[model samples]
Target: MKLPNPARRSISPFGQRGLKSFASIPGPTSLPIVGTLHKYMPIIGEYKFDRLHHNGLKKYKKYGPVIREEIVPGVNLVWLFDPNDIEVMFRCEGKYPQRRSHLALEKFRLDRPNVYNTGGLLPTNGPEWFKIRKIFQKGLSGPLAVKRFLKGTDEIILEWLERVEIIRGKQNLDYLPELSRLFLELTGHATLDLLLKSFSRDELNRHSTSSKLIKSALDTNSCILKLDNGPQLWKKFDTPLYRKLKKSQKYMENVAIDLLSLKMSLFSERSNNTQTLLEQYLSCPDLDFKDIIGMVCDFLLAGIDTATYTTGFLIYHLGKSPSIQMSLYEEAKRLLPNKDSPVTEEVLSEAFYSKAVLKELFRLRPISVGIGRVLNEDAVFSDYEVPKDTVVVSQNQVSCRLDKYVPCPNEFKPERWLKSHPLYQKNHPYLLLPFGHGPRSCIAKHLAEQNILVLLLKLIRNYKIEWNGPVLDSKSLLINMPDGPILATFHAR
Candidate 1:
């Protein structure tokens, strides 16, 4: 986790003081004054995270670094070019506190103040955050971190590979939803040992890609989360997309409620059977039904979506990069020779090439282009002053590509991360914000990593992949997903 380059510095805190005017503010004629007042209106249906990042880089180039641009009228915002400034925000989040502004997330049931708060975990803060993090990381320590997920993930991924083979050639195979369901299945079974209930066994077990009930619950979230990037949270309620998304949110909420009820009932019965993470939370003395709903829902929303998208992107890259693909195959074959044998955790871990490949993929296609926090207090960043309540954002997309930190940043080189690589430049230890950083960052970071690593290994080991889509497209929704169906060939290995 250490940075590649060690610099003389001090582990110091930002001294809070009086608010100051913008270092520099860019005029917003890009759209109109509607955006001048409320920025979300223009960005919702048009530009997504990818475009925003690209456009941000362009604007940053023209305007200046740390441009105080507004996403909405009257709402003060800053587009930061310097990774150091962003790193400061993350490292200081636990201390100075960068508050969340997501309305959908704020409305999330699991995040309620009274019961089952996920304070330090998800979208909460203060003591509630502290308690939630302690409880969540309780069982996720040491060996369990690597063993439980790695084993379950490997087995489920093999199942997924077999399913892909079933629909191969005869019909198009969409990897996103399939991988999405697979993560839920793996996480539910391995970590929690429960079924995702997202899809039925008949649907999940079906070799037919057509069998998937890709309903409003999952599909609508694409739009719902998309809307998250738009204007004020309440304004979205008036939009047609918002109405549809709200409905999708309702179905998902109901699903979580049912799962929570089921977990609670099992708890009342003192079910001796080993519990998954959700069940364990249900049994936690501190959490109630509301808290259970909030945290568990957070898990589902956060877990299923990003995993599917990331794997799809990784495979998309593999399809494009044949030499890398072959390298991965060589690594996988060495670790998992018997085609008939199921993938094991050890085998997945042994497939180091795949791990390296995944790291590169994440560096290239992190789900979030940037993460934002509204500074609760005016804080000084070098000479500039970041005002309180101003949305403080960091660009991980650009940070990964920073030439100083990552030499040849555009290349899909995984060796840069290995311990032995000479060209490898250590990124600012806290600057890699793939999962965000500090207290309010992702608590499920380890879980998400294990799932991706396990799934990637199973994929490379069992199937040879070739992309049917263009490798260069920056399509956007809310959280990044494939621009279209990721058509690809999967010859059984």
Candidate 2:
């Protein structure tokens, strides 16, 4: 279906006639004091806070494409399931797209005025966000900068694969934990040029710094979800969850500062030939130590679980479908004929099928619940006049799964994304943004994709993956992750 032009419907003058009032938008019934908060209450309510993606689909079915809810007394949220409205949301996002998430983390940073300049990239908005983003973008904004890390990243993948073989020992293994370690190592190498040795036999002990960092990140993420979704009494005072979040943040901060100091001390000795992402930041004249430290922490926190879960899902899908796996393997063999062949820029470009498979996985199982934005101006979505500053979320997850937008919504068909294939789908550009869009999009997009692609190439070329456990599903924990252990058998070819 061709969507109506979003440019024509949005950003009308305040006195414009015939535009429906924002209050008239359809939604679940709101109560006096609680607002729509009661709708998520146990037994009495239909929605579960953790199952927000499921709730989004249900909301679209019950209340059409545009749904409204006062999540809390003062927090009004408008969810746009229509791609056209989603387009409008982006177009009107203005210069600094203010995505109001990680409020608890933002407050945590703001409380520590001496340690942090702002809440980092994820939560900081407006001019402050723009300032930090510009400097970081210089280092990792495009594919060219990301391609430099491919060789180092490939080496890490090879080492992790060796560790995987040792750990699996001819049995179905829960690969998520190992994948997490692999990504942490990759992130460390790319960000700081630091070899975390996450997969090293000697470093496998629980007391290692890598292990502590991983644990702290996971604990911090869990606390974020709890505090963000719960009643948020922490905002007023230091709740136990808030305190726990601070403790985790403190540990991560200390690690980043120590690493930064070491890197600065060794900066002059390092060659000017191939610079690490951290080196690029240090070379920047504008960014201070505080800025670089914050970026490092943000990259580490954001990188690990996201790539781990995404690659986990990709592997799970390949294991479940033999035909798809075989097809991908043929492409992988063409690009990587030998097990030790380096995944260069040319190889990455030629691995079209592998790219499609990742795209399809993202469509079926996006990491985030949805892309959100606090509108910069008043806009009309689905004929309702949504006022400025309203939190309008683009429900890409729900939209991608609908039969109206996607032909085989439930099926894992990568061909739909290929232009040369007969099953090629002409989808709206805004429909499937796994890394989001525009200026506020993921800063580490290329690096993350490179990591996943290199891993996929090496793994598929070496083994035949098979799912050895129950049907897998996802549960949201800030980001969507496999609800149970990913039990898979990797049969060496």
Candidate 3:
């Protein structure tokens, strides 16, 4: 939607000219050998790329809306703080938008071509990406797919609520770990149809195979992020982290093979009418056990981390503001009046305030520093021409927090998302994209929203939420995760 007196300025495209022909964009001056790398040595020296967003925010404050910086020699990045530039980059992204591939992940999977034989969404584009994505769209997108998941996810949430009840007496709960385990259980049950029992403390205490497997998978994921955000030393030659990553990948693959075997047996015993994602993929002629495992691994990792952290941050925000908490409770009560009422699609649709809270949370505390796309062709953004194959990054956290799109940019105001609010009319809808738009928007968007909403419904219904902790901040590696555990309390409502 367009705003009156739009902040977007007209762009005059340069026809096939060199990027250097244009005026130099404002950014930190680069050193001859290292480019601008020396400036970031403090964070890089510690291998703490998670603090990248903080650094980016600092630069945005210093350099204004549009800045171009060379990350290292031979690698230049144009960081777009304006939402209109983000829109421009997205429109020019072509049919097969090339998301910058995760280096560590690509290497880990390609190293085991036997296991990860085919390229998945992250590494593939064009017809191959479309083909792989279509398979997921049929099973993971649309209302039917979302409907199939809702009941299962809600069941998991209710079970988790019981876990919360059991631990209610604790003075403070470490929200992220517990939330992580809950989403892990939900994703395992929903995708693999295997009850990995991630939320089961007893099973974990017993040191079961599933627990070990889950730990290995998580460790492997952590390694991928660390390596991706750290350095390219592992790319040229093997390192300790690379070795650990390989071992973790092997262990996870072995666990998946075992789980798939059991799943195949269970599929035989059960009726075809009820099938999981793995079973659906198994029906494909070209795909094998390994391919199915690879897909499952993607879903398992992607689903859990995103939902866990998003929900954790939303709750953290709610807990921080008692007024917001009370208003949310009122909305929850108004929507699902009865304590025993089941959370259904119809009920969730009417929970507008709850959805507003989530939207506002994303706008104020976006998880990623920016979303990146490799340009398919030469393009001009804010009248500055950049060449083809250049990596253009939308500084999302910066854009979302700009006063041009948001009123009192730093404040937490869920009302701004409400249609009745005057500020809502002034905003550009693209400014607050938690999920990047276009053909490559998150496939699990609906599933994650449904799950988060259901959990929020139950949470508000059950507990009077409280948060009296140090300021909750976020860190960004491959994705955004809370910098630390949020201290929270749950007084039974």
Candidate 4:
């Protein structure tokens, strides 16, 4: 159906068109007040959320790359899957690039004025976002920061491996929870300079504060996705999802405060002079106790799942392809001959094939279906003029899946990432940005890469990873993860 002409409606001083008038773009059929609510019923049948990605894929196929959808009554979104259009959309992004606002997150932060009056990097914008971002770069980025944490992070991974060995002999071991614990432990150690012990053998305390924090963060993420992608019901009332989100928020705030207090106590005692990520933040005079704690909590909430899921995807693909796993094993063996040796920044840098494998894995299965940006100015996709304030989503998954962009895109070909390969020419670097790009890219890129490389360095050296189960499908909930327990048999080398 044709949309109303945006130009005819009222305009903003910044040259924005009428918010509701998107007549130039094509989208699914919609009603007056309800918008496109009825059209999504089949996809959300009885609230089974697995169809979210599938529905998006089907819609893109039907509506072409640059399509529009009014998920809510007044909110309109323009989705783009074409690489060239994505380039155009990103080029138009102003100095302060704003991701699509998380309404649920904003509301939750506002509900608790004291703990999170200034929301963390995710929801905040303009000067505040830039300020927090600069602080994050100082604490989290740089070669020195990663080098300082390598030994400690590696020690935690080794402990996790010890935990994995206990059940390695089992026919079908559930690796999901274990991986979650692994990442939680890593993030905990990196941020707080303390082992979370979330994966310890105590059933009574199995759901530790660390575990609870990760769980709450994930639940909050799922709720936020539903609010934006599904019907806009949460906007009208305090629905069950909204309530759950609030409960999760409270849990997160409490845990963050406890962590902050612990760090403060340590600071007073001068127990250790080592500058951990939290220590660096605590030293920042501009930030208050609340903001510092919020930043640390943001590290845990944002860091755990994305790192865990990305690692899982790497294992899933490598385990499925035995030859590829062998090649990776050989590469690791060549880089650092001693299997028992600790991985260093120098060694990791030379581990070219391993890095390529990670790059390829992300290209195939990005963290989410696409990256989102709220256009700061009017932009054009194809012939359609998308006005300012419109949410533009770039379909990275679809673009990477296209054979034209990357030859044999579906197949697991890590060599494509290596410039030496003939197929490498087929690759467009922009098409596979797992960490995103530009000034607002993921600040934890270096840390995450080091974490994964260290874990894989040990993992490939010690075991022949294999997976034989029902085809493991991925569900997108902020980060894409295996839909069910990843059953794998780890044979120790």
Candidate 5:
């Protein structure tokens, strides 16, 4: 599995002599107008959009590491399965990495000129994205910024745990919905300085703001997967799926505006001693109100699913492995000896085993099928000279699980991440990128990890988690998520 040294590869400004042409990259035979899109169609199709991670593995085995597919007629996608090639892709990703995801979402935002300045961070590219990113980075980029929310986030987790106890008296529960609410509440606190009260017993009504926001976010994401993966008919005209996306986005937009207005009105009354993420943005001279709204909308939309799915999978793995769960429980107990102890920066730093558990979970089941970048410059990958503007996807989920990159890839061995362990992996750093790499990486990375770690510590200490259902798998809906009901049993200690 040793790859040829990238340094030895022939280098050129654009195209290189004796190197494989981009057209020569092995892939499934694409048809006339349909391209390889038909291959993802119903029964005859060999692939399912929802099961893209599985499809990536299958493609890698069939076509070898580097794969080419014209997903739509003219859109050529190069899939990189080799960690070395993935590293090359990122290295060439340039200052403003153009990730061509959520085209339909971008259109949706641009269509509404009055409401949006740009398509927000997820879809926007170049200087506009960098401008907003720099502003938000000041508020959310590092551990110090995320640490301010430890007490508040812990309070939210405690509330959700109480709700879980009431809802799951003695039965296995589909906990994803609860997890979604918990993350949404956390996102609200971090991004908008609002307590969404998503877990409030009195706000059980389905039409509540929190409930509507959650539903819209989920619905919009579903529509995004369908529209982005399928035909470009939505681009030509207002298709049915496009309309659904608009509706969901419109709802979210209204909610963001209302919340922003409320927060701004209360801004003057707040103490100058502490600043929430929202207040920091409002106080920044460079950002306009519209810019703040765009950021809040993006954060709310993106935050919930990633954290929810990652936590769900982590819990499942812990439940499935009793030894690992016990080990993590022991670590959690040591970190927070009292049941009601708050998760501080010191507690987080000391929870080394808990950190390893998260790292291992990410390797096994990444929240996204792959990390994608629309190549900013022509780059050589796997000896093929791929041109600039081609969408090169880093199939990390498939590669991370491969025996070539990781030892005992199928086993849940957190020790692989521990430096002292015999099974410790010195795998390529690019092999596992759950938060992605470089500047375009997830802005909320620190905050999300803190939230997950705090919740994990609390859950492991409080309950002996168990799962007796069928083995869990993931489905891609913009982000990879648990494919079935998370029917995990929580046995109170």
Candidate 6:
């Protein structure tokens, strides 16, 4: 039973490939069109984020540090890693834009641009990005975020803790939706003050069409994510999925316009007690309505998604290892924080084991597999011609997982990050960048840290988490999730 060569045909997302070098690129050799696709099938559903850190390591080892393959017909992507390449990637802020490449990132620009646009920080590039980045540095980065965000985390997290307890006594539940709801609510209040403190205890919640437009922008683009590298059916034809994806874009565009219109009724009246985020933007007379709202939307998407998934991973790993879990709980209890003594600037700074737990979780499961950067110019890397618009994809996931950095990357070891370990600070400062690095890093880095810290402290301090079903690993979907409903048991401490 010999298989005939199918490389003579054209390859699209829905097409076939005729290139010989395709099989040699270190991907799964057996189902070529499918390639490594089946291995990822375990990831199709809700618990996706749980396994991303594991899959990243597996694929990188099976392939090479750098993998080149078609995500779709006529589209090729290179996923590369090597610390030296960091400078090649981030040194310039011009020719290389974040949203370029197969992201079909062009599709995201229906609205006017700001920080998250393909040029400023999240995904954007150019002279405009450099200037805008400066404002972020002065306004959002470093000391200010740490100073302002650390205090509010306790109140926000305590509210989420009660919501999470619904699954604590139950068995075989889909806790991710719970986590998402919690994260979304937490992000809204803590970051934007856009929603109620606790989930409205209501189902079929109302969302403005403009809000839908904001979500649609994410969903439509998200629909194209892993599809670029799979089979070739939808690419060559007007598949229903493609139609739906296109329709979503149109719906979102109309939604964006509706939300962008300046209305006296739409604006929230300023009060002295309004959250800092809303206050800052409302006072920025230079920021137009459409762009500011879009930026707020972008901020929510990035901030909420990362924190939810990362906090989910932290809990998952903690549940996986009992000894470390015990250690964390004991340390948190030793500190004994109360509402009267909430997680404050000093409390967060003083909590040594909390830092270890977070750093270890981040080391093992960086929410982003690698930090993405746009090459500002056409550059030579190891004498390779990386064109002006090329996107640099580093293997931060595998980098931190490697034996050199974390010893046993697969095995969870909070002990590796202990203060006594001499290699703790000096060995590689950016190895565990769950919040990202450099100037373009997350504006809510401190905010996320505080949020996760509060939630984890509460959970560990109250109960010990154990599994009631097959242990799940983190998977990916834009960010990350567990492979399925995480079934766990909680014993009160």
Ordered list by lDDT, greatest first: 5, 2, 4, 3, 1, 6
User: For model 1, what is the error of residue 271's alpha carbon versus the real structure, in angstroms, after optimal superposition?
Assistant: 6.1
lDDT of 4 by residue, 250-271 (tens): 8877877887788789787886
Best by lDDT: 5
Q: Would you estimate the TM-scores of all the predictions?
A: 0.83, 0.96, 0.91, 0.91, 0.97, 0.74
Candidate 2 clashes between residue pairs 3 or more apart in a chain or in different chains: none
Q: Least accurate stretch of 10 residues (summed lDDT) in model 3?
A: 3-12
For model 1 the local lDDT of residue 98 reads: 49
Q: What are the per-residue Cα lDDT tens digits for candidate 5 across 403-428?
A: 87787898999988899998885778
Model 3 agreement with the true structure over 24-139: per-residue lDDT tens digits: 77877867876676666764442235676666677788877677777555667778877777777887788888865556666878777888865566656677677677776567
CA lDDT, every model vs. true structure: 0.62, 0.86, 0.73, 0.76, 0.86, 0.56
lDDT of 2 at 228: 66
Q: After TM-score superposition, what is the CA distance of residue 206 in candidate 1 from its true location, in Å? A: 13
Error of 4 at 353 (Å): 0.6
Model 1 TM-score, 2 decimals: 0.83
* Whole-model lDDT, model 2: 0.86
Tens-digit lDDT track of model 1 for 133-211 = 6777655643456465565566666666666777777557676777767777765564345555544555555452222
